[model samples]
Target: MRLMALFAAFSLSVSAQSVTRAGLTVTYRDPADRGQLARVFTVWQKAAQDLKAKGLTLPPATLTASRNASDFASLTGYPAHIAAITLKGNIYTQRLAALHARNLLPYTLRHEAFNLAQPPDLPRWLAEGLARVFSGEAQKDPPERTGLETLSERELDTLLARASGLGLNRVYREATRRAAQRLKQQGWQETLTLTSR
Candidate 1:
């Protein structure tokens, strides 16, 4: 059964239409969704620029848009695929509506892009936090309050509450907020060095 499923996903991926932009290639089932493709490319380009400004490099990546969340889950082995995911050189996402519903396509893509840019050994807090910061989700909070070391246990408790019910969004938000704070205080290079440890 697993082999059959893998084969099916492989076939689908192979058969999908592909478009390349800014060192990233995106594949999807519908040729008509070129608008989404354009948006994705724009987002990636902006993300690459942002990372570069921060003295980081974005590795080449391939993105695949699945027909639905179920297909995305099947392909990625995630119970709920959410907005997007990156595995090594590849990124997988659902169609545009789903991504737009959560306003997460850009954020998710950038998150995975960060993973590709940096070494894989980063702690989850740092990784998710940096992604969220880069993706513009952590702009509201002051940098001084965001360090993981500085965050109180009560704050963490509040952020982690109802995790299963609300999904990992809160956790990600906290991490991102903390990361943003780090970026502001230490700059990207130092933050990257600290997190890579």
Candidate 2:
């Protein structure tokens, strides 16, 4: 009986409910934005579907512009956020920025969903890197030539000088090798944890 109780507790600790709201979940709070609710609803549904394709599920949530109502919302893009969190039979979340650019929302949803699934294990950098990679938005090449040239002229001149001696092909090859290693070791969970932070 004691073992069964412990097992139940352990299972409950890992799985939790998640809600995501974006767009006008907040605007509705103010009478003025009520008219925009339809637009917000349309966008929110599409965003949710996009996220679903990545294996992250969102429960029914209010889409709002006001940060207070959301568990998370983007300050820059669609001002959608979510607030309530029910974790392991308890609530866990406060307010946070959750929305992202239309193109990036799917990745962000997957990233956050992984954190919810694991709860307090994964690091942030790896999570974000994973999201970026999964979304096909990962940086495929080294920093742009413009940035490199600017750096050579303004700062890190010695480093740039050394780089100039190295063959471009060698640099590319080394980068590819490192990327593969990182992917093999981190996988999706580590990547999500890396970015969650």
Candidate 3:
């Protein structure tokens, strides 16, 4: 069954500049970005439902649209290459404009949403792979022909955590490949259930 039936309901808050509903809150720093923020909120409703249709329960999260690149990096402590991250019920991202410009708004939200909804104890390799797969981002990866499939889960986890640059991408690719294979053979809910232990 889709997780929409399972996602927990959350309380909401209302204000002049921020609005919360159905486990999500959209906020912006500048008045001028109101339109974009509203659009994000609207899109998020469906995004949540879509993920629900899979097996992830979208939690109550505050999505704060950072004003600029440096602000996003500062607030999230992530590189500019990172689109968004969900931490402690807060979703931080690049400016709505930047995301929209890069055509990354929806997938980025879905990717982070997958991360947010996953069980915290799941192995990093599996979790990252599943996040990319669930968000449909895995489909964007180039084909992998060598050097990663043989690694143990611990080794894969280490590479994913410590490797930077192209090495990181390779780890991501391998992880995604493994995750997709698992999903294809079993399914997301069961995959999550079995691998989490």
Q: Rate the local accuracy (lDDT) of all candidates.
A: 0.72, 0.38, 0.77
- Candidate 1 residue lDDT tens string, 1-197: 99999999888655778888799988887544556777788888988888888788898888888877788889898656467777767888777656766777776677777777875666667776787777776664444532345666345545554354344655666677766667789888888878333
Pairs clashing within candidate 3: 4-52
lDDT of 2 by residue, 97-152 (tens): 32332333333333333333332443333333343454343444444442332331
Q: Rank the candidates by lDDT, best first.
A: 3, 1, 2
Task: Output the TM-score of candidate 2.
Answer: 0.31
Point out where model 2 deviates above 4 Å.
1-27, 67-121, 126-197
Q: State in Å the error of residue 183, model 2.
A: 8.0
Candidate with best lDDT = 3
Positional deviation of 44 in candidate 3, in angstroms? Answer: 2.1
Clash pairs, candidate 1, are 129-175, 129-176, 146-178
Superposed by TM-score, candidate 3 places the C-alpha of residue 131 at a distance from the truth, in angstroms, of 1.0
Estimate candidate 2's alpha-carbon lDDT, on a 0 to 1 scale.
0.38
> Considering every candidate listed, which one attains the maximal TM-score?
3
What would the TM-score be for candidate 1 when compared with the true structure? 0.74
TM-scores vs. true structure, each candidate: 0.74, 0.31, 0.82
